[model samples]
Target chain A: MAIRYPNGRSYVGREPNKKPNRQKELTYSNRGMTLEEDLNETNLYYLEKAIAVIHKKPTPVQIVQVDYPKRSAAVIKEAYFKQASTTDYNGVYRGRYIDFEAKETKNKTSFPLSNFHAHQIEHMRQVLKQDGIAFVILRFSLTDEIYLLDALHLLYFYNQKDETRKSIRKSDIEKIGHSIKIGYHPRIDYLHIVDAVYFSDKL
Target chain B: MAIRYPNGRSYVGREPNKKPNRQKELTYSNRGMTLEEDLNETNLYYLEKAIAVIHKKPTPVQIVQVDYPKRSAAVIKEAYFKQASTTDYNGVYRGRYIDFEAKETKNKTSFPLSNFHAHQIEHMRQVLKQDGIAFVILRFSLTDEIYLLDALHLLYFYNQKDETRKSIRKSDIEKIGHSIKIGYHPRIDYLHIVDAVYFSDKL
Candidate 1:
């Protein structure tokens, strides 16, 4: 018998003598999920477990024309994407304001500073000055390694970019940042790193 | 001769003999600005002064089709608005997470409970559980009175709508909520109220 998955893909029942390849399935599980998808799943897990209240802001768009057809919902005819002025995700966790941006880089040797905009850097500075937790989640796609780098270190490298290397070397990230191991339930478990880095004493 | 404003409106020079009506201008200044506009201006003021980092999230939209022209930017051809799963505005303030939804009503006797959706109420509940500062900004257009009602009070009235009244009476709001005076600089100086309500010890 054949069964259809929720995604509408048909799957044939496993053959009586065939063994499931668990290792291959585990490896392929992380293949299609992007960093955004991982973070979204992780954030949803956080929210459902009553652990945190982080959310990604919607993509900004400039709407130019809309048509309100009779007895139908309004449809946008023309719109353009607008640049975001702040980081992607933010929320409250453990009585603290949490703010961070997530980016995936295919480059293995280093994470380029150009991945960040000057205004985003400036926004992080303001968040830090206001005593909120600020950081970035950097993921290297080739190795599937993820690191949480503090905004302070990111700002340092960004400000002195013209004088120094354009990107933060991978070695520096491994030394200064905390690695996040992807898991099944949450995908990217970052709040554990937050608890260690920001609320260690309380813990 | 006519001088054009940055908004593209052309204005003729004032008559030499005519006297400027400062009172009328002051009264009309608040006429054109909506509640969202006032909040946006106020949030910008807070951001520029390094006081807080608050922003109104962009409207959520579901893009269905996009067309990328040969030598131009991508244009969204078809899209529809999506219901927001959270409050419209959220950010950090003085090391605490701040979240709120703003609404303006022309009704004078009461603010309707229908102004809030179930998911928004649920979102506020989650934020409160996480120890974040959550509230709603209510603007009564008839009297031009603005009040910051705590989420606890809002949730109480919202949850008890069937047994009690369908709306929160203006009298109840005036007694429980904090009034924010309209100002010239920030337009709506809400942080002072925040200081009094949430950070009284530090203040």
Candidate 2:
């Protein structure tokens, strides 16, 4: 079966002719999963464990035409992708609203500002102003390193883009952001970082 | 112009030949707007005023085929609607997470359980378990009455569907739910009721 991720990436199963080697297959699958897929698995783990309730919002689409056939499901004939105005993932965590955007960069030195939209940054600002916990999950894919950077630092860097470098240096992220270790059960264990960053006082 | 609401309802503009009277047009427009449209406007109002940051999640779609035409946007050729696993709307309100499903019933006496899905009720349970606020915004279309009923009450009625009636009587909702008054600026001012119900002590 062909499965499509919310980000429009198609999940192609293993080739039918390939020899089923469990060890190699496991490693290949883990390496093949994208940042979004990792987060989706992590969120599912949270949900199943009754820890948190975060979900990646569906990709916004501008549905132009839909055909309804008798006694059958409506088929979308034409549609276009719509830019999202808010962060991708959001939900309740420990009685507080948690919102964040996740982006993976192949760049080793810095994460580019082009990964974010101005409206999304504005949305994060609004979330923070409303006392919601806002942040971004940055993944340096080449090194498999992920960091949870608070929206405060993100907003500051975003505003200084014109004056400063157009991207946030990896060194700066290491200094300010919380490192999240990738785990087996929950691929990206980000909530642990969220706990330390936002609920340290309570802890 | 033809505009489509997230709920799949298409908005047809006034006929070009009709005389446009300001007062009559205003009333006609308001009456024509669905509960979803009213909530969208209300959420936009809240966002603009810095009151809350609520949003309706996009309608989930499963894309089967796409055509990548040269030098233009990718066109979704074939797709089908996917059942939503969560509520229609959610966001931060006064530092707390708020989530809810909205539905309008033409029946004047009761709201049917068929309006909800099992996973949605399960999702609400998870949200409430995380200490987030959950509720349903129900509209009685016949009388144009709106109510914000807490998830506790809704869950109770939903669970009793098999034993008792498959619907919650309007009288019972009036007794348990908070009535939301429709206004000019924000069509349905639900946050005011949320303040009284959830944040009364803080108020």
Tens digit of per-residue lDDT, candidate 1, span A1-203: 66889989777656543443554364534367789998999999999999999999999999999999999999999999988999999999999999999998999999999999888999899999999999999999878899999999999999888856799999999999999997888889999999999999987
* Candidate 2 CA-lDDT value: 0.92
Q: Residue-wise lDDT of candidate 1 within B97-203, one digit each (tens)?
A: 99999998989989999899999999999999999999999999767889999999999999898856789999999999999998878989899999999999876
lDDT of 1 at A129: 98
lDDT of 2 by residue, B72-131 (tens): 999999999999999999999889999999999999899998999999999999999999
Note the residue pairs that clash in candidate 1: none
* TM-scores of all candidate predictions against the true structure: 0.88, 0.87
Docking class of 2: medium
Report lDDT (Cα) of residue A101, candidate 2. Answer: 99
Report the TM-score of the second chain of model 1 against its true counterpart.
0.86
Give me the displacement of residue B201 in model 1, in angstroms: 2.7
**Model 1: residues with Cα > 4 Å off, grouped in runs:** A1-30, B1-30
Per TM-score, the best of the predicted structures is 1
List the RMSD of every prediction in angstroms.
7.1, 10.1
